[model samples]
Target: MTIEVRVPTLGESVTEATVATWFKKPGDTVAVDEMLCELETDKVTVEVPAPAAGTLSDIVAAEGETVGVDALLANIAEGEGAAPAPKAEAPKQEAPAASGGGAGKSIDVMVPTLGESVTEATVATWFKSVGDSVEQDEMLCELETDKVSVEVPAPAAGVLAEIVAAEGATVDASAKLAVITSGGAAPKAAPEANAQAADGKAYTATTPGKDVEDAPSAKKAMAEAGISRDQVTGTGRDGRVMKEDVAKAVSSASAAPKASAPAAAPRAPSPAEDAAREERVKMTRLRQTIARRLKDAQNTAAILTTYNEVDMTEVMALRNTYKDQFEKKHGVRMGFMSFFTKACCHALKEVPEVNAEIDGTDIVYKNFVHMGVAAGTPQGLVVPVIRDADQMSFAEIEKAIAEKGRRARDGKLSMAEMQGGTFTISNGGVYGSLMSSPILNPPQSGILGMHKIQDRPMVINGEIKIRPMMYLALSYDHRIVDGKGAVTFLVRVKEALEDPRRLLMDL
Candidate 1:
């Protein structure tokens, strides 16, 4: 029997995708649910997995080719031929352990505990395979948890002896991942070295005995940088190549001419030269989704931004007065976000249109507020909603925001937490953004942008005084919210924030 592998649904509003890379080629055996290829869409890259354990028989779609959702990617031949091949190759792979001397010195690679709550993670990608050379501290694989992606490093230099957990496999912390044959010799350098060695002198050109005793990391680095082991000055035990030496060589390779001839006039390179200097990498699924959604929000919505300035003096004073006590009582710091969130909730209640969305030809008004708080992560910006934020106490709001922000960056947020936000608040002020009009998180009619505070002269009762002021921007869907309503909403938020007691009074 032959099984057809098809691309899965990419995401909401994502219909088509480009084949980014194929992990398995024709004649290669694959296990059930094993990832075979990656499909890159405008929103995210989706992994196509094997339908069954079999041998890859054909590739219907090639790399860089576009295909719609559920389109056939390849075929796999199952039954006898496919099933017996892996068994046949198993002995050949294990043969090295029996034949090689000092094989028992291999280092066991185990999964490290991620956190108090996390115990298991999925193997995201494997950088090196069995028999592939690796260096100590070099990334060997990536582990994906509910909240974050962690890179597993090589424990010792040598060959990747075995793989206990394949990509997409879930394992507990402290579980064996793979093994590295420490003290084993590296594989011969690429054919490029042999070409350089054609003159015979190339082999012995580097310091005598330098390449022989070089650390696996240094040797791997030397090969990648195209520098002979002898050329780099060793800084490791017994004058062996260190990872840093390889890095220096790589850095030097780019600025080689400049370093050698500092007085020479620099010349512009041609298109070919420029192309050689550039690098291309496939975007991750998270980044693609962020780009697509943000672009779609701009094209589909009638976005109008309204600005206002808020006096932060009162809010700061309140926080300064009670932050210590608040932290001690609630076990979470009193942050400015909770205050702003409360103010937005109150304003949203008064001005309901800002909390509404356009559903096809009709207006959808949400009675309950699921406030989305924008958090920046290494991957991209993610908004996790605090359900019924309007009903949450200040201490509860502070705790939820802190937990969600931490989980968002760690990649632990659930899909439910990111869905169905009635309103959003983005604080670019944390990043020193003086002012910015934030875009709407689609379907939601409004987003409040908070910016950096600065001391400016202001009149408070006929006297000029320096006060901390912050610029606020509210970007809303003009289709749903009117200019008057947008302005009125901003004013209400400002009033609530400037007078923090209003939040307590629900005024």
Candidate 2:
């Protein structure tokens, strides 16, 4: 019997994905849950797993192809005839069924509805060569779309037999990618979720090796994969392959059956070797959106920034004294951000114009403060809101800030977490910046930029004293917030920070 395996729907509205890479080939036996391939969207990456235990019969797709959520990826023969055909079709629901000897079967790599608006993706890459052995749940290829990257994995275990698509080709979300056949005599399929590789293991733990020489190559495979090296079953000695083994893996990647090294692709130029050429990747959806929003704020608002300086001695002392106690009691850190955030809240309350939003022809002012804090991530910048700043205590504010910060780093924050903020606070000092003219978040009238605290001598009561001081900046929508409002807003923040109790007192 030839069984068809398909890609599953990634999420609601997400229609397609891009092929990332394949982890297995034909002729290899795959246990259940063994990773087969990786898929990518512009937003995130997903792992594809094998659905059965069978010989990998054919490869219907090549690397760098796009496929849909429910498209046929491969076929698995019940016994030794597992050809492990490669799937090349991008996801399309109209795909007809292909059967084996007695009858051709339909292999379905499902069309992925990644988001409400996303209907299709471009196929990215395929991992296996025809005749190579494939294991269940081993990655086969990758797919790409507007949101993130996606991987296609082996559907079963078997030897590879076909190549479906050429590399760098595009396919629909429901298109086929690859196929696998029963492993050995066809062991009962294991649960997919429970078939994950060992934690932090050098290679695929489910297929651990007893030999020792292949150890170095296994480690190398893990590193080049960069994303899910854990998903690959190591063929190295003791299942350990170091970085040095990458050349060997690449050389043998395209050959199967009686394997032989294929000609290597042209190598990428190193910075030291190629001084003139600079390669840049395309901008991500989030980054493009961020650029548009920031430029919109600049063009739409009459913005201006004012600067001020404050001594940091008192604030430093307070943080040093209460940091441990506050953390112990509230389960949150005692950081300078809370102080600055509180200060901004107090200041915004005093200068209402700074907290107002420009809604078309009207100046809509907010009574409650929803402060937006800027957090940096590999994707770009995201500002998450600390809702109802007036109502939360210092510890609560710190806790909220930290939680949102973590979420931003993990790319787990949602759209709702980013909306409805009336003002923004950005701290460049965390990266060793002394001062910066902060930009404003759109609609809101003001933003505050915090600078590094440094020791400098200054005259106080007719005597020079060394003290830690910081510079603050307030960027405001000058159309609503005049010079007075800007200066007042910054002072309020400075005062609140200097007198830590003022934020507590609501004064």
Candidate 3:
């Protein structure tokens, strides 16, 4: 029997991917759950796994060819190895002779279904140990997908018999994780729900004194948060703390204090070890897409940037004065972006070409503003759109932009939130950028870059005065928008921002 291997669902907004590399070829014996090939999408790389322990019979999708989600990638001949192992290991029926129990059974703890398009997860943490007793529905381990962290619960009240999947190992949905032996006594079962380890608090399957390994992303997060591994509640396989886990620990006051981590003793380097080392890693789907899109924009568009400076004195004073009442009335903090977004809306209306796209010999103009706000994340930069920005009030705009930014950092924003924006606003001010020429997000003809606000001496009515000023760069496609229109559009935004009454009175 030949079982067809199909592409699993890609994450939100990603419908298809290119076959980057094939790990196995036809006639090659592959174990059940072994990766057969890699599918590179716009957001992330997905490994296509073998459906059964068998010889690869045929390749349906060749490397570099695009294939949609659920499309056939290859075929595997079943029973090529000892009757293929089940997607999940079944519990042993026979009881061990030493353990006096009726029909000793062991149930497999398999990876649970996460959500749509999520096929596999990396083991982040394991709460229970081999020979440890666990209660049903209790969190046994945590699984980290590309987007979120999920805790795996115990399926049965029994002793953890064996761990099939270790921390940092990635497994498919419904794949075997560990074995739980029913009616078996734990060597030293804890009396309470949250009991500490007797030998040591470190929850791992490794030998004593061995340094615990963390996934690279998780390590970076932990380091940035100034947290040691033991201080975090791990959700990765084998009780390994993931990046999100550290983030949560940093946020919560109740999180554990720093614990001494096992150190790897330093050794004198050999001649080979002293040489410069290099490593190569495949670009993630998100990074790859970003590169492609930026290059495409540069190649296709007649890009030109127009610059101007804005005095933020009045806007800052307005915010400082009404921020308290604004937050109370709207349930969201007043921000500079909302003002800019509203100002841009009015400007885009005056210069419609900035909000237009080229559609193969025709120019398509949008009446309403769909604003894309660029936010940086650990994975990469993402721009989630605020639909119909022109129709929204200051409070509404602030709320929408804030929510998108929060979700972007947490990796919770959906693909729909990322698609279809008429104009983009990228604020380099938050990162202390003095000036930058922001790139245009294609299809959209324009992008507005906001720079850091600095106190500078400026001439006012022939007298020098200190004022808060910001440099703004408007990058637009010259193919659709003329230099005059672009400059006028930027000036309108500057006028609206400089004088707050213009935004309130629709000036």
Of the candidates shown, which would achieve the greatest lDDT relative to the real structure?
3
Global lDDT of each candidate: 0.77, 0.65, 0.78
Worst 10 residues of 2 by lDDT: 189-198
Off by over 4 Å in 2: 1-276
User: Could you give the candidate ranking by TM-score, starting with the highest?
Assistant: 3, 1, 2
lDDT of 2 by residue, 278-348 (tens): 33234445666678888998998888989999888889999999889998999888998888877887877
lDDT of 3 by residue, 210-262 (tens): 33445556667766666566677776555555677777888884455677899
The numbered model that scores best in TM-score is: 3
Candidate 1, 135-237: lDDT as tens digits: 8899887776654567788867777666667655678765667766666553333212321121233322123344233443455556666666656776754
Give the winner by lDDT: 1 or 3: 3
What global local distance difference test value does model 2 have?
0.65
RMSD of 3: 10.4
RMSD, every candidate, angstroms: 12.4, 15.2, 10.4
Give the winner by TM-score: 1 or 2: 1
Candidate 2 clashes: the total is 173
